[model samples]
Target: MTQPLLSERTLLEIAEHEGLVLKAYKDSVGVLTWGFGVTDVSGHKVGRYDTANGGSRSSIERAVEVFEWLLRTKYLPQVIAAFRGRALTEAQLTAALSFHWNTGAIGQADWVQSFLLGRRERAWSEFMNWSKPKEIISRRKAERALFFDGRWSGDGVVMIYDRVNPKEPRNPVWSTGREIDIKDEVRAALRKAGSAR
Candidate 1:
C-alpha cells in the first residue's frame, strides 16, 4: 500500500507553531511576509508588498490555502527528494517538513546529509546547530525530539529532560495532555524501509 501524505494533525501542529498573521509585515530581513511566514508570493495574488507598510491584508482561509498549496507543491517534493528511498512515518515526514519550512532546502542541509549517510546520532545532534534565536532554538529542540523519540512538543516549548531533577515541571499542559507518541508507527516505517532495501 502507498503511504499517506502529511496528516491534518501534523498540518495543524505546524500552523499553530508557525502562528497566523492576517497582515503583511516585514520579516527580520525586511522581506514582505504574510500568512504563516510565507515570504514568496510570486504566483499567487494573495499578498502585495508596500515599501512603507509591508504586505497587504489577508484572510486566514486564504493563508491556509496558500500554506497547504506550498506544502504540497513545493516543500513536500523537496522533502521527498531529500529522503528519497527511505520510508517515513507521518510523524517523521512532518517533522522533516517543519524543518524544511523553517530552513530552506533540506537537500543542502548538513544535518540531512548526515542522516542520509546513516550517521543517525550525528544528524540528531546537528539539529541543535541550526539554533538561532530562543524561539528557533526551542523549535529545533522540539524537532530533534520528534525525529528521535517520536514525541511532538505541542506548546512550542522545549524542556530539558533531567534525570536528577525529574520532578521539575515544564509546561504542564503540554507535558501532560498535549504530547503525542508515535514510536510504534516510526518503527514500522523503519522496518518497511529496511525490508524494501
Candidate 2:
C-alpha cells in the first residue's frame, strides 16, 4: 500500500498556528526559535548568540523550506510510528501531526491509545490533556475538530510576528504587519517532500 501524505490544508493550518518568524527569537517560555516555531534543525540547537551573526531573519521561502524539511525528516516519522500499523484518515493524520509538532508527545499521548482502542469519545476528551501553557487551548480545539469532525479552520495566511529582544522575558511579538499565503508554497513543498520520501 502507498504511504499516505499530508494534505496542503494540514500544512497551512500548522503554519497559521505556529506563525512565521523569519528571525530567531525567544518563544513563549523562552526557547530560541525561528522559521515558524522551529527550535532546532538537525543537531544544531538554536542559540542566543546565533542571531547576531546574520541569523536574524529568514525569507518566507526559507521558512517553508525549513518547515517542509522538519516535517519530512523529523515529525512525519514520529506520527507514522505512533500510529503503529493502523490506517489513518487524512484528517486524523493532520490533527496528529499538528499536535505532535507542538507537543512532541504523540508516542505516549493517551489519546493515541484511546483512539487505537476505539474509544473515540474518550480520545477526544483525553486529547485536551496536553493543553498546558494554556495558550494552546484553541489550537487543541482546532486539532480535535479536525480529527473528529474533519473541520478545517483558519485562514490560509501565515502571520509574521515582530522580532523580540532575545534578552527580555517572553512577550507576544506583535505582527510585523506582514502575512503570506503559503497555500501554494506548502502544496508544492508537500509534493516534493512526498516524492523525496
Candidate 3:
C-alpha cells in the first residue's frame, strides 16, 4: 500500500506538538510562562534574538515566524517539486507542506529535492527524522513523533517555530521571495507567521 502523506491541518498540529519554554515569561521561573519555542531547530533559549520575547517581537509570535521562514526559504521549493504538476490530493499536499514547514529540508535541501524527484517513503522518513535537537537524542525522538503524526491524516496540534534566537537566524529567512500559500500548501504554511498571521 502507498504510504500516507500529511495534510495541512496535520502539519499545523505537528508544528504545535513540541512545547518549549519561551523567555518572555521566564522571569517567574517557578511560576507559569507562556513563551516557548518549538523545542529544537536553534531557538531553544527564551530571551535570545530569535525566540521568546528576545528580538523585536514576542516568543509565541516568534515561533510562528520561524515556521513560516523555514517554509518560504528552505522547504517550499522542494515541496512543490515533490508533487510538481501532479494531482496530489489537497490533504497530501497540505500535510507534506506542513511537515516541510516545521521539520524543514535544511542544510540538506537535497533530500527534499530528491523526495520531490523520487516521491518515495524513505525520503518522507528522512524528512521526519530531520527534526532533531543538536545535543539531545530524546528531543529528536519527540520531534520525530510530531512529524510522523501527520504522516497519516489526524488532528495534531500545531505550534509556532519561532526564529527570534540569534542561534537560529534562518528560522524566518525566506530569500526565495515568493508568496506563501495557506488556502493551499504555501498559504497554509505561511499562516501565523509574522504579520501575515
Candidate 4:
C-alpha cells in the first residue's frame, strides 16, 4: 500500500503545535527562525533580531504558505523516507514532523531509529530526553502522547521560554497527565487563521 500524505488535520495540528510567528527571531540556539520554526527557504536564511541583516517580517498568510511548503518539500520527505516500510497513523506522522521541526534531526534521532527497529517502548522513553525549557518538555510530552495515544491537550501550541522565566513551568500537569480535545483546538485555530483549507 502506498503511504498516505499528511492529512489536513495533521497539518493543522502541526501548525497549532508550532504556533504562528510573523516576525523572525533568534531561537533557543540563536538561529534565525520564523513561521513555525522555519530556518531557511529556497536559498535565503531567516533573520536574527540581533543582526543588522534580519529577514523581512512576514504576514500570517505568507508565513503559513512558507510553512506548508517547507513541510511538504523538506521535512515531510525526510520523515517519509525514515519510515519507508512502516505504516504510520496521521498523528504519528505529525508527531514525527513536530519533533523534526524542533530538532531537525528526527531522521537520525535514536527514537525514530528505535521505532523503526520495533522497539516502541524504547522510542517512547527517548522522547522525554528532548525535554527542556518546559515548553520542549511539554511538546515532547504531547508528541509522545500523539505517538503512543493519539491525544493531546493544554494549549494547542507549545509555549517556549522567554527571558523572564526560562525555568518556570506552565501547565505542569500536561507534561505528566493525559487529556483530550487538542484536535478540536487545532481545527479551531486553523479555521480562525483561515488556513484550514
List model 3 lDDT by residue over 105-154, tens digit each. Answer: 43354444555577556654665455444443444444344433424433
Q: For residues 1-197, what per-residue lDDT tens digits would candidate 1 score against the true structure? A: 24346555566556656665455555555555555577764234434622133434554446656766677667877888888758777777878888888887578878888888899999998878788766688778877888778887664221221111112221112223232333233234334333211
The residue pairs in collision within model 2 are: none
Clashing pairs in 4: 47-55
For model 3, the stretches where C-alpha displacement exceeds 4 angstroms are 1-11, 24-59, 69-74, 98-103, 106-197
lDDT of 4 by residue, 1-197 (tens): 55455456666667666655545555566555665667764223565321234334555556655666666667877788887757788778888888887777876788888888889899889888777667678778888998889884434443332221112221112233232233454444445545454
The CA lDDT of each predicted structure is: 0.60, 0.77, 0.41, 0.62
Using TM-score as the measure, name the better of candidate 1 and candidate 2: 2
Give the alpha carbon lDDT tens digit for every residue of 1-197 in model 2: 35566667767888888887666776677676777688864323555324544454566776786687787668878898998968888778888989989988999999999999999999989999999889999999999999899988867897876565545653336754477788777766777776322
Error of 4 at 80 (Å): 1.1
The TM-score leader among the candidates is 2
RMSD of 4: 7.3
Q: What's the count of clashing pairs in each model shown? A: 0, 0, 33, 1
Judge candidate 4 at residue 89 and give its lDDT: 80
Point out the higher-scoring one by lDDT: 1 or 2: 2
**Range of the 10 consecutive residues with the lowest summed lDDT in candidate 3:** 27-36
- TM, every model: 0.70, 0.87, 0.38, 0.70
What global local distance difference test value does model 4 have?
Answer: 0.62
